[model samples]
Target: MYVTSNFTWHQLAQHVGGIQLQLEEKGFVKGDVLLAITPHSSFELILVYLACIEQGVICALVPELTTLDLDKRIQTSGAKAVFLCPNTSLTLDGALEIDFALEQGLETQNYSEQNLTSLIFTSGSTGEPKLSPTACITI
Candidate 1:
């Protein structure tokens, strides 16, 4: 579900719940990772996690983490794609901010268990950010 506010969690959940039931009726297995890049309070993050669980995919929550941190995590987990919010922006290697916009309608994609869900960078408590694998089951 797409959302622009933290208060939208309940509404998004209702929408996604319907979609999940529909998908189940179709006999399609849920994907393994619900990737999110929005702020922690955003409803999208919550819906993604719920959807992942309903579909049996792992939920990965990655936010405000540096690219270096992301790189380490991605390399370690082999995540297929990172789910990013359309209006959000992040700086890349050249200081350019990349923005991903969500489409206007419903969309679905297939994924495998081998796919990386999310890579979490360690907080440098050990002197460096370490990547950790995030999966649906881990949620």
Candidate 2:
């Protein structure tokens, strides 16, 4: 949860949690899809994933995707929103639902597993990737 160069884990979590609630306020509900196209290991990447989990949004972490490919992926995934990290250069010009890094926070919620928590993107070296949604049920 290294949000900033020096922020503590709790601090980063709090900030991301706020963003999650804000997204919820903006209509991110259970099983909605959110596209995150950052380096898979970056802090913003994980933060967004956690937030999506809190609000029941399915997060798709797809890296190295072309702009057109991303658009196709979003379409295929039925994503309700998109999150472009600070380091991401790809743009979704005509995307139906998209978001950049939020500088604000909102009310937060505890982690509750949703019906669909994440999506896996599959593509060969030659074409647009397809997304398959999956949910992990705790026993």
**Which structure among the candidates has the greatest TM-score?**
2
TM-score of each: 0.50, 0.73
Residue 17 of model 2 has an lDDT of 71
Model 2 residue 91 distance off true place after TM-score fit, in angstroms: 2.9
Model 1 steric clash pairs: 32-57, 32-58, 57-136, 58-135, 58-136, 59-136, 79-116, 86-100, 86-101, 122-130
Q: What pairs collide in candidate 2?
A: none
Name model 2 segments beyond 4 Å from true: 1-9, 94-110, 124-128
Model 2: per-residue lDDT, tens digit, 1-139? 3443676777766767766867777888877888877755676677777778777788888775776777687798888777776666666564323243454555555456536778888876866676667775741
Predict model 1's lDDT versus the native. Answer: 0.49
Question: Candidate 2: minimum summed lDDT over ten consecutive residues — where?
Answer: 94-103
Task: Tell me how candidate 2 scores on lDDT.
Answer: 0.70
